[model samples]
Target: MAGRFDGQVAIVTGGARGLGLAIARRLAAEGAAVVIWDLDLTGFDADKTSFRPASAVKVDVTVPEAVTAAMDDVRSSFGRIDVMVNNAGITGPVAPVEQYRLEDWLRVLALDLTAVFLCCRACIPHMKAQGYGRIVNVASIGGKEPVPGICAYGAAKAGVIGFTKSIARELAGSGVLANCIAPAMVETALLGQMTPRFVEESRNKIPLGRFITAEEVAAAAAFAASPECSFATGFTFDVSGGRATY
Candidate 1:
């Protein structure tokens, strides 16, 4: 699997850092010409990376126009989009449903669920035209387990899982596969948003008694977004450290 992506083009949304960055790096290492889409380019340093990406474009995935423009840029520059990793998202305020604000909920879904949809909608045509593609959407364990105090985040991620399932069904026998990754609180900047108690309680829930790492997630994503993963679609690759068994 060393050069699983050689001669292919891959796009990683919100890939400037954290889980996205890790996945982007892995795809590049496997020989994919990786391109990242993010509002911030602070964490993406081409020269400092082990596997330098083809480019990092500043695109706000939440905006349909921006996403379309960026996809065009990628296609114009790289020729084809072989893989798309929807990794951009945020863990909305850690508050109970009763305390959650409507604005916060809207914001969460806009980036988490809606953005995934927009990116998929924008790229599927390109992939369909080429007759081959792999779509790996980053979901969360909160979508599987009923985690309280984060209604928006949980609901949005659940939507991603459901959305991915439908995408796979629609693309069946179409040379394109869609899957999701449900990770249980990986130790990335995502943790910084949570309260100390929130992080510890989540850790205790995992039988492994620890949070998963970004590199571990990247490894799993590499396979899901690789051509080697040809048979599985509408599946969830869990990196929950025993928090989720199904």
Candidate 2:
């Protein structure tokens, strides 16, 4: 049987590790050509050899020029980009809005929100030309519900949700589709930064009584990027492990 992404070319930002890495591995395993754009290029060297059509490039998503250059490099190498996953993000210091530092807040916003805009801007034209594309953005459950002590991260992710919907509407007639995924407390390296108390508290809040796995989030991402996703643009898929109810 053929793979779901056979012959497809995909760009996965922040794919060096965590949820992004999981998504990249899935896509590549399914026969898609995968280009991983990440600031940390370590350990990914092995990925190039293991994945048939895979390459890793170091990139800071906040820089528009760098993002554009990476996109161009992927286009030159792969001929065309069939999918783009905006998964680069940062969780700034957890604090109340009043205590949040401006610089930190801006940094989080730049990476979590502005970077998505930059990647989408660079990739939409290519998708439009091909008359087919999939854009899967990694938002957070915090985007929909209020999360204390992480205002900046929540706000940025919320913006991603709104931006994705708008773009999906704009490209409604086009073959491209845009969607967002909101995962709650996934087990990743990033979660290590949270305090033990916070982690335990979060676990308690989840009806499942456990954290979601990165692979679960990757499954949702694959679905969004698959050809079957044609009818669902601007939609938000929740991977909160029952933590979020709507």
The candidate maximizing TM-score is: 1
Per-model CA lDDT versus the true structure: 0.93, 0.89
Candidate 2 segments exceeding 4 Å error: 45-53
Clashes of each: 0, 0
Best by lDDT: 1
Give the Cα error of residue 146 in candidate 1, in Å. Answer: 2.8
Query: Which pairs of residues have clashing backbones in candidate 2?
Result: none
Tell me the tens digit of each residue's lDDT in model 2 across 78-168: 8999999999888878777899999999999999999999999999999999999999999998898857888999999999999999999
**Global lDDT for candidate 1?**
0.93
